[model samples]
Target: MDSLLALLKKKSTGQGSFALENIKCDFFISDFDKPLLYTFAPFGEASADTISWGFEFGKNLDVNVIAISLVSNESWYQDPELYELALNLGKLANFSEILGYGGSMGGFGVSVYSNILKIDRLLLLNPFSTLDPNIIPEETRFRWYQRNLEWDSRFNDGAITCSKGVVVYDPLFKLDALQAKRFKDFKLVKLHGVGHQIPMHLNKLGLLKRLVIDFLNNGSDFAWFYKASRNRRFYPGYFAWMQSQENIHLTQRRKATITKCQHSLKKLISSKPGVDSVTGKDIDFIRDLALDNESKDLMKAKMLMEIALKLRPEGEFLKMKVSSYNKRLDGPDL
Candidate 1:
């Protein structure tokens, strides 16, 4: 049950660390000349006691970093303690530029506090505008945490304060799309099938660093983002999520969007022809494709699984999938 600051201080004892109520902040000074990056850690059980998001990324770039995290999930950062913390942090003159970055709950913090922190720019991914149920009645996803929140307070609506930043989100996700509408001033990058975990998915596709660095350094490059986003087609669970949407709640536009994505996937698969063999590197891609096909075409799933297993001989999950498909295929018709 160690505090985030305590856990972080174990590795580097001299760094600046502070805790006020449920909020914690850690400061790492890499260079006096480089811009400071403020990263807000998202809400999650696994990362509750870890350093804020973008710790290593900021360290690698030799920039000053302020890592902020809330120890408990109950507070959606509505604490008055933040204003006091921001007032002190805003006085530092080492940073030439002050930028904010965060995702989900973290994104909410970055946006809401941008003006007070004197943030020059920001990068928010799938951030909620406000957790106030009255304002966002359609959003029913986080009721457990929302039940006891003090929503009517200063700096509650991040959409009002977050004027300069890029907001990346999956437009096909109804709730996220609704959230995006609140950030009217910021530029929107609608990435369809990547879901709410936009940053993670982009990282998997080897695009997160380029996307983030380019934005924080040079504002934004829409053409570059669009081109890079197309690589989602090759992501492991991308097509599977797209194809499985029939069972989920989707807007009319989202349904049409998925249909278009399915068309593009079909063309991509057709161009690649058949998977004759798979190398160690290709095993994951092949395995994912196999799983995607399991519901619709068991025969094709079996073939791809066989190809993947040849490269990954010790793959127990692949063996199970292959066996299950074989049994279903060989059974008599009902």
Candidate 2:
């Protein structure tokens, strides 16, 4: 598995070039003292995950490489431990600096690596806020990997630790759906109308080269480079159009769920007045929702307290939920 993992990791890093097909990972060791820069790629529909425009960018500027491919896509979710495992591999791989590649789900995941996994710099493409299976509905392009439970997000404020970040959004991002932090925290370059696809933005190499040159040579923010790129190659109307599409698709799903909830209530109501009250049946339904997957989402259970209040209105269950939710809201490890 380690060898296979290494091979896959290589394909993602690309052998220090712009070749997208036979992605192989290796460092362009230019004198042992050269500053190291780690890079990662987005694992989309499994087609272009190996492209290393990021690597090409860095190596061309004469920087060493430490790249990995815990890419974000529907597929890698099949085994999340692997994602974590790939994530942890950076420790073993040697590098003085860090680089994160963005594509599809990789967009946001790479950014978070700053804190969770710890890196220096990252170049993110289209990223997502959360890739949990429970969030996205079936029939969507992302639905396939949702089958694997590991897609659940384990991110927080401290997750992204890069000193400098460069993010590129689909000129037309679907939802703006991903949290703004992916953009707010770094220098962003949004490309519109592009799907979770990669290779469309291979020019991403330029961004990488600039980062290496600044950090390795003079020690700069690389901020000016980011702004200059944005001003010159600006794409208009892409973000607005994506926002419109996102609203429509997301709204459709929300409406469907509300309808389903209405129908299910009919059955719950019809079965009333059955089995003995001693069975403690009525109470548990509300209690269980609070408990079900409570570990993953304490805030949700808290919000549902209002619904639980409606389910039983006033009862011991309501109190229990409120207390549980509040306790969690305070902080974990409590």
Native-vs-model 1 lDDT? 0.70
Per-model CA lDDT versus the true structure:
0.70, 0.46
Q: Model 1 compared with the native: what TM-score?
A: 0.70
* Least accurate 10 contiguous residues by lDDT in model 1: 1-10
Candidate 1, position 217, lDDT: 81
Tens digit of per-residue lDDT, candidate 1, span 58-146: 66556677778887766777777777777656654335788888888888888888888888788888888888888888888789756
Best candidate according to TM-score: 1
1-334, model 2: which lDDT tens digit per residue? 3543353345333233221122333345453345556555555323334533355555655666544443334434233463455465554444454445555555544555554445666555555545453543322554545454454445422223545665555543444335334355666555444334423432321233343344455443644544434421222222223335443443666556544654454444333334333123654665677677377555445544534554454567677767766654432110
Name the lDDT of candidate 2: 0.46
Clashes of 2: 17
TM-score of each: 0.70, 0.45
Cα deviation in Å at residue 279, candidate 2?
89
